[model samples]
Structures are given as C-alpha cells and as structure tokens.
Target: MKAILYLPLCMVLMSLNLAGQYAIDAAGSYVKNGAYSAAYSVGEVSTLTVRGVHSTYVSTSGVIQPDPLSITGTKNPGIATIRIYPNPVNDFLRLETDRTDLIQYVIYSMQGSFLAQGTVRGMSVQLDYLTPGMYLIKFSLVDFHESQSFLISKL
Candidate 1:
C-alpha cells in the first residue's frame, strides 16, 4: 500500500523536475509536443516539442510567450549580410557590404520617410548630413531586402 503511494509521488516529482523555461528569438514561431523534448531548426523556422508539457509559438510579428517547463530558442528568418557601423553615429554613418557588385542602400526616418538613397560599389555608405534620431537602414540585393532600425546620437 505504501509502495503504491510512493510510486505516484515519485512520478510527480519527476515531472516537476522536467519543467524548464525556453525562449524563441524568431518573431513568429510555435512549439508543440511534450516538454519540448524534440527540436528542429530549418532555415528561419524552428520547431520544438516536449512530452506532456504545453507547446509554445513565437512569430516575428508576434509576442514571445515562453514555456516554463520547456526550453527553446529561434533565429531570425530573414537576415542580411550587410553591416552598419558607428550605429549611434553623430554626423557620419557607414554601411558596409562584402559584395563587390553595385548595391542599393536607403535610409529612412523612423516615420518611414525617405532620407537618403544611393548606389555603392565598395560596400560602404557615408551619411554626413542626417540628424540624430531613430532611423531605418535598408539594404537590397537583386530581389531580397532587409532593413534594421538604429539610433543616432550626436557626441
């Protein structure tokens, strides 16, 4: 009789021990299956599952709600090779790329207003007149486009 009760108690304890927390970096994603015991990563999408635990879903545009019993992480779906330097620039901004071919770059205000546009062959852009504020920097390949928002402050 006591042995049967002990078995049940042990199972409960084991379940509690399995519960853990996980975070997904991607914007729009979801997790399914027990305590997230299974995991898969393909390109920009990631899927995880744990036995007997709740599933989690994270999306690029969605809120991040992590499961306490299961741990998971995700990478961004769309990432570019372009890089920006002096992120918090005061006067001049530099955008660099590895590609030797012509690249199109655009700068926009946080409000989505176009601030500057030009072509570059050396993989770098120098912005010397833009004011200090939050702005969006967009780099475009032949068909793919990636944009990141950054802040600028005068030193």
Candidate 2:
C-alpha cells in the first residue's frame, strides 16, 4: 500500500525534473529572418549585442564582414588584422601582417607591469628571455593610431 502511494509521487517528481531539462528560457530579444539575425540583451550588469548572417548550406561558408566599430578607443576606421603563431612558444614569436608600415610591440606581465618593448624585426620577436608563464603583448602601429593586444603563453 505504501509502495503504491509513493509510486505516483515519485513519478510526478521525476516528470518535473525531466521537464526542466528541456525548458527554454531567454532573457533577451532575438530577431530572425531568412539569412540574417540580430540579438541584443540589456541587463543591470552588462549588455551584449550580436548580428550575423546565417549560412544555409552544409558546407558552412559565409561572408564575414569586418566590424566597423573600433573598440580600442582609436580614431582609425578599422583595426589591422595580425596573426601570431607558434603559441606556447619555446623561443621566438612571429608576427605576420599585410601592412608595410612598422609595428611596435610591448610585452607585459599578467599583472600589467611592462616587461619589454620593441619593433618587430624580421617578423619575429625573441621571447627566450621571458620566463615560462603567460604574458600580454600589445601591438601598435608606428603611428600609435591603432593597437591590439593578445595573450600568449611562454614555455
């Protein structure tokens, strides 16, 4: 008799738990059409906005447009795209970019103390002197009009 009474209660509790797993709760607004969608959320702590073009095909290719807004507090129209490689680097870090102008770089500790600064010579920077750890490197054009920073690991 007790088993029969507990069976229905157990099933009810199990159903409520299972239903919560599929619950969809969204706090922000999302608009979707055929190929483009935009979402934005405003909260007391922070705000986020996203806009993108959807790719329909299975190949998964879409035109990536450059973000016109500059987040570096610079007046430049856009930030230059730079590539750094051989991360978790052993000795040297290489920088590659299409810009012909000189670029200045500064290496700083994770605690925000300046460690090193120099121009990219031969498209590479000798990081062997840095101790094994994580560092932040900021790269800015010679004009100082635009800059970007990346986190890198040294090993």
Candidate 3:
C-alpha cells in the first residue's frame, strides 16, 4: 500500500532534471555524521585530513575552503570509497569519492519526489536554492548503486 503511493512519486522525480530552485533561509552550522564529520567556516582548515590530499568541504554559506588541519604528518585515505557528510545539508553539499570514474547522483525528497540529480563535479553540489526539508541522495556507481537520506535544515 505504502509502496504504491511512493512509487509514482519516485518515478516522477526521476523524470525531472536535477535542477531545484528555492530560496534558502537561515545561517548554516556544523553537522557531524558518525566519526567522519567535519564542517569548516569560510576560511578555516578542517581537522579531518587524509592522504596529504586534504579534501575541501562546502559551508552552509556555500563557501569552499581548505581542509588541512596540520602540515606535519601525512596520511592516506585508507578506504577507496564515497562519503557524504553533514547529513543535514544546506547551502552546499560536498561529494567525495576516491575514484575518478563517472558516478551519477540524484537527490530526492523523502516523499520520493526528485529534487536534484547530476554528476559529481569537483566533489560538491549546490543546495542554496533548495527548501529546508528531508531529502534522499542516490549515487550510481559502475558496479553498484546506493541511496542515502539527509535532512535539509533551514538553520
């Protein structure tokens, strides 16, 4: 019964392009997800560094900054995988993947409505135009596919 209701919504969202336009309200804050969560301000270095290649994170203000907390020791990103942090996304979302292969990602509303979809470019996605709410992001890799939901908070 519930599947019937959500099926159409998912289908419709898939049909729509990955461009969602809505006014974003409130200031962005830090949201840590699990042990691998970090959010830096407009011009601050993040503590989470891996493989000497520190990955930059997107601020709720939609600003991108460096991710190097220190410069003494070097580290390598242990696992070659994809990671999306600050589940409660806003302003901008960072999409990180160790592989350079083509991966398609789609953002959908909790109700299964498609919100955004596109290829990961520079490991980030702009969300300043989306309304605050819960959303699901589905990533399509070459060998497998996965979906994860996130809360888009106005604050």
Candidate 4:
C-alpha cells in the first residue's frame, strides 16, 4: 500500500512540474499570462493604412487625427454627376445621370464579391432577384474610363 501511494504521489509531482510555461527567452522581451504569451521588439516601425472605394488613409506615426473616412453629404469625384433613388429599394432601382453613354454595370455584395453584371438598359435595372441586403453597383461608360460606384440597399 505504501509503495503504490508513493508512486502515485511522485507521478502527480512530476506532472505538476511539466505544466506549461514558455521556454524561449530572447533578450528578456517576452511576456506571459495565464495561457497567453507575447514578444515585443524595442525599435520597430509600425504603420496603419486604410483603403476605401473613393479614398485612402495612412498613418506613419501614432497621432490621433480627425476621421478622414466619414461621409458627410459630400459626393465622390467619380460619381458627382450620378444619382440613384429608392436606396432601400424593392423590385426595380432607377439610375439618373447627365450622360447617356453609361453602358455597363456590375453588382457586388458589401463583402466585395461580384453578384451580377449586365449592360445598362434604359434608366433602371431590375433588382428583384437579389436577397435583402446592402450592395454596390458600379457603372461604366461605353468608350470612356469614367466609372462610378454607388452603394444601395435591397429590401
């Protein structure tokens, strides 16, 4: 009985000694918490970059600045002359533009996945097939590089 109990106690002690903790220590820059670990460098350049459909943002140094991505009733240069109505639309969505040369359009989901594409017919496109969600429609000219993207919703 004593031998069996002694062996079991020794196994438990050994197991406790084997409990996990990070083994790698490099220049003493490692930090560890319960089940979490991280290593840090002393001198490293970090930057933040954000890209949008209409603009781009970058931060080289850590400084708080006004949000450059907010939409404040201003128009994007590419789509300044373009307009769409019935934003949260049902059945059909209408397009209004000064230029009648708009020839093609592509529909994309909010996650940037292409869902549909077709030539522009008349002044509207039938969106009755799309499930209710947010989408983006890109319109392009027939013989020009001018293209515009508009965000719309399906209801």
Candidate 2 lDDT, tens digit per residue, 1-155? 99999999999988883533121223446566544566544333432344458633322122223323334453544567789998989899988887867999999999999999999989899999999999999999996488889999999
Which residue pairs clash in candidate 4? none
TM per candidate: 0.39, 0.50, 0.41, 0.47
Model 3 Cα shift for residue 86 (angstroms): 2.7
Candidate 2 segments whose C-alpha is farther than 4 A from its true place: 1-78
Worst 10 contiguous positions by lDDT, candidate 4: 62-71
**How are the candidates ranked when ordered by lDDT, highest leading?**
2, 4, 3, 1
Candidate that scores best on TM-score: 2
Please give the RMSD to the true structure for each candidate, in Å: 16.3, 20.3, 35.8, 21.2
**Top lDDT hit:** 2
> Sort by TM-score, best first: what order?
2, 4, 3, 1
lDDT tens per residue, model 1, 28-63: 445766435323333434445444557555543223
Better of 2 and 4 by lDDT: 2
lDDT of 2: 0.76
State the lDDT of candidate 4 residue by residue for 14-68, as single tens digits: 8885655333222336566544455543422555689999999975532222322
